[model samples]
Target chain A: MLIETDVLVIGAGPAGSSTAKHAALNGSDVIVIDKKSEIGAPKRCAEGVSKEGLKKLKIEPSNRWVIKELSGVRMIAPDGTSVWLNEEKVKLPEAGYILERKVFDKHMAMDAARAGAKIMVKTLAKGIRREDDHLVTTLETMGEEFEVKAKIVVGADGPESRMGRFLGLKTTLKPKNMESCAQFEMVNVKMEDPDSIEFYFGSVAPGGYAWIFPKGDDIANVGLGILTTETDKSAYDHLLEFVKNNPSTQNAQPVELNVGGDPVGGMLKELVTDNFMLVGDAASQVNPLTGGGIITAMEAGVYAGEVAAAAIKDGDYSAKKLSKYQERCEENIGVKFKRDLKVKDYLQSLSDEELNSIADAFHDIELDTINTAELIKQLIKVSPKALLKLGKLF
Target chain B: MIIMKVNEWCMYCGECAGVCSRSLIEVRENSLKFDKKKCKECTICIQVCPVQALAKEE
Candidate 1:
C-alpha cells in the first residue's frame, strides 16, 4: 500500500488527532497512524484536565468521557499540614474534570476522521528517509509493509518518539529533567473530599509529588512522579509506600496500573526542520510543575496543523517556513513553562521543614481575599529563606 | 561489549526508549528491543525506568 498525503501524522493521541483535524479542515489531505491496535488502551495519564484547557480548544465537557468534576485543589505537606484553595474564590480554572482517557482519546480521533483525515491503527513507522522534495516513511502493520509519502511529517508520538530521532532531532531527556511516574486506578477508597484533587509534597515523593485525582465517590487514580536522580527507589516503590502510608488509600485495591516517563523540563529548542514538525510529548510541551500535557499538546497540534496547511499552500516546506509553528507555541505556552520550571526547581530544593513552614503560612489565610503577591509577602514574613529563592518567579 | 538488559519486571511502558540518549531502545507490545551494536552504555535508560526493569550488562 503506497499512500501519499499532504501531511502524515505518526500517532493517534490528542496531539496528532488535533493536527490532522485542523490540517484536513484547511484542505490538506492528512493521514494518522498509531502502533496500538486500540486507540487509547493501557492509559499512561491520570486523566486530569482543566475547564480552561477545554475552553481554549473549543471543546465542551461531555458526560461520555468526563467521570468527575472537581471543585478545588488541596496541597498537603510532609508533616500533615495542608492548604486548600477554593476554586471559585481563587478564580483559578485549575479545578476541572477527571476523564476516562480511553474514551476521550477515541472521541478525539473520531473528530479528526469526521474532518476528513485518514486514520490507521496498529501501524508502526519502521523508518523514514528523504526523497527529493518529499519524505518517504516505511510503515509496518500486522504482517505486511507499506510506505507513506508526504510533503509534511508531524511527529506526535509521545515522550519516546522514534519518529523524532529518525528525523535527526535531539529529543533525548536528561535524568534530572525527566520524571519517572507510576499510577494505579484504585477502588474502595475513603476520600475525605471527593470533589477536590490532592497533592502530597516532600520526601515521600522526592523532587516530585504524589497525586490523588478522584474518579468517583469511592475510586481514584493514585499516582506519583519522582525524579530518578533524587532517589535510588523506583517510582513504583515510592507509590507503593505512599499508598500504604496515606490514610484514605491505605485499604484501596488497585485494579489498573500505569507507568511511564514524562519530560518535566528541557523543552526542545527546535521543533521543526524541513518538512517535519514535532508536537506533544515529542516536543516536550508538558507543564514543568504539574507534568500535564494534554491541553498543551492539543494547542501545539492546532498550531502545527495551521502552519502545515499554510506551508503546503505556499509550496514551501522548508525549516524556515515550518518555524512559524514553533513561534506560535513559544508565544502561547513556552513562556509560562519557563517560569514554571524555575518554580519547580525552587520547590525541589526545599527541605521537609521548609515545605511544612510554607504550608503553615497558607493554612490560616483567606486564600480568596489575597493575591499572589500578597501571599508571597505573607510567606516571606514567615519564612525569609523562601523570599530569596522565590524572588526569581516575580 | 556492553548491552542493555530488560528484566522480567519490565512493563513495556516505553519509558526507557524515550530517554535513551542513543535512541537504541524500542518498546514493542510485549517486549523491548535494544540495538546493542549502537549502544554507548550511557545508562540513561536504566535510570529512567519507572519499574527499574532495565540494567547495564557487560
Candidate 2:
C-alpha cells in the first residue's frame, strides 16, 4: 500500500506529535507514525518542566495533566548545609509543574489530529528507500507490511533513532554525556512540602541527582539519575536506599518503578539532512544540566513542522533547506545549550569536597533564582581549587 | 537495606548535613564527613549535596 503525504513524521512523542500538529496546521498534508500501539503509553520522563519552556511551544498548562505547581526549589550541600538562595521570590504565574507525561503527550497528539494530521499507531518505519526525488519508507503496521512515500520526513524518534544514524550524522554519545535514570512512584509517603520539588546531589547519585517530585501530600515520584561513567552503581540501587532510610517515605508502598537513559548532550551534529530533520532526543535537544527535553522537543517539533510545510510549498527538500530548523533552534537556544554543556562538563569533574564547598558558596538556589551560569561562576569564585578543572570545562 | 558510601571527592559543603534530618553528616577540618553508623543511609545527603559526592551501596 503506497500512502503518500507532503510530510511524514516518525515517532509520536512530544517532538513528533508537535511537529505533525504544526505542519498540519500550516495546510500541509501530514502523516505521523509511531511504533508504539498507544500514542502516549509507557511514559519515560521525570515530567518536570519550566513554565518558560511551555510558553515557547504555546502550550497552556492544563489541570488534567499537571500534577502540582511547585512553590520553590531547594539545593543541599554535601555536608547537609541547606540554603535557600532564590529566597527573594516573585510569584511566577506559570512557575513549574510535575506533569503526567502520558496525558500530556496524548493531548499534543489530539491537537495534531484535530489539525488534520493522520496518525497511525503501531506503525514502525523499518527502512527508507530514496527513489528519485521522493523517499519511500517500509513500515510494519500491526503485523502487516506497507509502504509510504513523502516529500519530506521528520525524525522525532527518541534517543534510539535510526533515522539520524542511517543518514551519517554523529549519534555516538559518550558515557559522560548520558544519564541512566530510575524512578519509583510511592503512595502514602510523607512529604515535607508537596508544593516544592526536592533534589539531592553528591555521592547518592554520582554524575546526576535524585529528585522527589510530589504528586500530592502522600504521593510522590522519587527518582535518581546516575552518570554511567561517574559511578558503578545503578540508578535503581540508589533510589532503593533513598526509600529504605528516609522516614518520610520509609513505610510507603511502591506503586511503580521506571528506569531509562537520557542523552545529556545538547544537540546533534546535523539535525537536518536531505529530505529529513530530527527533533527531540533524536536531535539531542535535552538540557545538559537538567536532562529535560520536553519543551525543547516541542519547540523543535513546531519548527520542523513549519519548515516541512514551507519546504513542501517551495518544492525544495534538500539538506540545505531543512537546515533552517537547526538554525532556528540554534538561534533560540543554541547559546544557552553551549553554555549548559560547558557547565555539565565542569560539573562531572568535581570531587565531593569541591561539590560541598561550591554548595556552601552559592547555598541553595530557589525557584526565583534559577540562573545556572551565574551560580557556577559564584562557585568558581569561592572554590579556587576547582578553577583548574573549570578552565578545562569552559 | 540502604547502603551509604561516601566517595573521595566530597567537598563538605554541609548542605547534605543540613538536609539530613537523621544527622548523618558532619563537617570537620573543612571536609564533609559522614557517620556511616548514624547515617540512616537515606541517601538524601547524596541527592541534596549538589556536588554528587555521596553514593548508595547496592
Candidate 3:
C-alpha cells in the first residue's frame, strides 16, 4: 500500500504531533505516524516544565492535565543546605509546575488531530530514502508494509534518531552529555509540601539530580537521574536506594516505574537537509543542564511545521530554504541552551565541597527579598566566568 | 516475572529505559546496564529498542 502527503512526520511524541498540527494549520497536508499503539502512554519525565514555555507556545493551563501547579522550586545540597526560588520571584526557566505527562502529551496530540493532521498510531517507519524529488519512506503497521511519499519529512523520532542519520547529520551524544533517568510513581507518599517541587543533589545522584514532584497531598512522582559514568550501580540502583533512605517517601507505595535516557547536548549543529528537518529530541533540542525538552520540543515543532509549510508553498524543500526553522529556534532558546551547556560543564567540574560552599553562599537569604537578578549579581562576585554563564539559566 | 538482559548489539541509546515497568535497566553514557533481579521480563524494553540491544533473559 502507499500513502502520500505534503509533509510526513515520524514519531507522534510532543515534537512530531505539534509539527504535524502546525503544518496542517498552515495549509500543508500532514500525516503523523507512531509505532506506539497509544498516543501518550508510558510517560517519561519528572513532569515539570516552565510556565513561560507554555505561555509562549500559547498553551493555556487546563485542569484536564495538570497534576499539581507549583509556584516554587527547592534544591538540596550535599550538606543538606537548601535554596529556593518562587514563581513570583524567579526568571524565564525557573517557574513552573509538576505535570502529568501522560495526559499532557495526549492533549497536545489531540490538538494536532483537531488541527487536521492525520494521526496513525501503531504505524512505524522502517526506512527512508530520497527518491527523485520526493522522500520515500517505508512503514510497517501490524503485519503490513506501506510506503509514504512526501515533499517534506520531519524526524521528531528521538535521541536515537534514524532520520537524522539518514540525512547524514550528527545527532548522537557522548555519555558525558546524556542522562539515564529513572522514576517511581508513588501514592500516599507523604509529600512535605503540596506546592513546592523538591530536588536533591549529591552522591545520591552523582552528575545528575533527584526530583520529587507532588501530584497532590499524598501522591508524588519520585525520580532520580544519573550520569552514566563509572557509577557503582545503575540509575535503577540509585533510585531504589534513594527511596529507601529518603524520609519523606520511605513508606510510599510504588504505583509505577519509568526510566529513559535524555540527550543533554542542547540543539544539534545541523537539524536540516534537503527535503528533511529534525525537531525536538531528534535534533538534540533538550537542555544540557536541566534534562528538560518538553517545551523545547514543542517550540522546535512549531518552527519546523511553519517552515515546512512555507517551503512546500514555495516548492523549495532544499536545506537553504529550511534554515528558517533553525534560525527561529536559535533566536528563541539556542543562546540560552549554549550558555546552559557551559553551566552543565561547570557543575560537573565542581566537587561536593564547592557545591556545598555555593549553597552556603546563599545561606540566611530571605526568600521574599530575593530575586534571580540579585542572585546572579551575588553569584558574579563569587566567580565571574562561572556564574556569568549560569546567570541566564534561571 | 520481568526478566531482562542486554545483548551484545546494544548501541546504548537508552530507549529501552523508557519502557521498563520498573526501573531495572539504566543507560550508561557509553554502555547499557540492567539489574536482572529487578527485571519483570515484561519485554516492553526489548520491543522498543531500535537496535535490538535487549532481550528476555529467560
Candidate 4:
C-alpha cells in the first residue's frame, strides 16, 4: 500500500504521539508508525514526574494514566544518610508523577488519532530515502510490505534510532555515555513512604542509582541505571541484588521485568537534517543527570511537530529551514540538559564520603528553601571549597 | 550451555558487557574481551546488539 502524508512520525511513544497530534492539529496530514502491535505494552520506566513539570507540559492530570501522584523525593547515600525534598515546596527543581506508562503512551496516541492523525501499529520503518523533494519511508507492517511518502519525517524510535542512521546521520552516544537500565514491577512492596520516590546511590548501582517508585502502597517499580562501561554485570543483576537486600523492598514479589538503555550525552549535536528530525530518546534529549526522558521527549516532539507543519506549509524541507527546531530546543530545554550532563559527570566522580557530605548538607534545609541559590549559599557557607567545581550546580 | 560469538563489526559499544549477568565481556579502549566462565551462553547479549555484532554458536 502507498500512503502519503505531510509529516510521517516513526515510533508512537509519547514523543511520536505528541508530534503527530501537534502536526495534525496544526493543519498537516500526519501518520505515526510503531513496531509494536500494542502501542504501549511491555512497560519500562521508573515512572516519576513532578506535578509542576506535568503542568508545564500542559497535560491534564488524568486518573486513567497516573498510577500515583508523587509528592516528594528522597535520596539515600551509601552509608544510609538521606535527604528529602517535596515537589510542592520546591520552586526551581522539577518533580511530578508516577504513571502507568503503557496507559499514558496509549492515551497520547489515541489523542493523536482523535486529532485526525493516522496511526500504523506493528509497522516498522525499514528504510528511508529522498526522491526529488519528498522522502519515502519503506515499511513492513505485520509481515506486509508497504511504504509512506512525506514532506517531513520525525524519528522517535528510542535510543538506538535506525531512521537517523538510515540517513547516514551517524550520531551516537559512546558506551560510557549511555545508561544501561533494568527494572521490575513488584507487588507487596514495603515502601517507607508511598508518596515519596526513593533513590539509592553508590556501588549498588555503580555509576548510577537505584530507584523505587511506588505505584501504590503495596506495589512499586524498582529499577536502576548503570553506565554501560562501569561494570561487567548486567543492570538486571544489580536490580536483583538491590531487591534481595534493600531494607524497604527486600521482600517484594516481582511481578514483571523490563530492560532498556538510554543515551545520557544530552541532545545529539545535530537532531535535524534535510526533511528529517529526531525527538525523544532517539535524539538523546533525556536529562543526563536524572536519566529521565518522558517529558523531554514530548517537549522535543512538540517542537518537531510545530516546525514540520510550518515547513510543510512553506514547501521548504531544507536542513536550514528545519534547523529552527534545534534553535528552539536549545533555547528552551537543550541548555538545561547540557548542564545536567556536567552535573552527572561530577556526581559520578564523588566518593561515598563526598556523597554523604553532600546529602548531609541538605539535612536541615526545608524543601521550600532548596532552590539553587539557597542550596549554593548553604554549600558554600559550610564546605565552600570542598565541592569546588561541582559546587557550580548550586 | 549457550555461547555467543562476536563479529568484526562489533562497535565496542559495551552492550554485550551491559547485559551479561556475569562479568563476561570486557570493553577496552579499542577492543573487546570475552570470558568463558562469566558467559552463561544466555544469548541475550547477542539478541540486543543493535549492529548484529554478535552471533549464536551452539
Pick the TM-score winner: 1
**TM per model?**
0.97, 0.81, 0.86, 0.86
DockQ of 1: 0.80
What is the DockQ for all candidates, taken in turn? 0.80, 0.02, 0.10, 0.07
TM-score result, candidate 1:
0.97
- Model 1: per-residue Cα lDDT over A205-279, one tens digit each: 998999999998799999999999999999999999999999989999999999998889846888998999999
Please report, in order, the local distance difference test score of every candidate based on alpha carbons. Answer: 0.89, 0.74, 0.78, 0.78
User: Which regions of candidate 4 fall more than 4 Å away from where they truly are?
Assistant: A91-94, A367-371, A380-387, A391-394, B1-58
Residue A207, candidate 4: C-alpha displacement in angstroms? 1.5
Ranking by TM-score: 1, 4, 3, 2
Candidate 2 lDDT tens digits, B1-58: 5666667755432334434554445443234545676656555546543345678887
- What are the per-residue Cα lDDT tens digits for candidate 3 across A1-394? 7788999999888899889989999999999987667766677677778888888889998988877778777777778788876677655353376677888888898999999999888776767899888999998777699999999999988765666665677765555556777789997687556688888877888888888888877888899877766364667778989999888789998898777677787788888999999998778788888888988899899999999999999999999999998899899878889888887777776667777877788756775686667867776665566565565566
Q: Model 2: what is its DockQ?
A: 0.02
Model 4: chain B TM-score relative to the native chain B? 0.79
Once fitted onto the true fold, the runs of candidate 1 whose alpha carbons sit more than 4 angstroms away are A91-94
Better of 2 and 3 by TM-score: 3
C-alpha RMSD (angstroms) for model 1: 1.3
List of chain B TM-scores, one per candidate: 0.90, 0.69, 0.74, 0.79
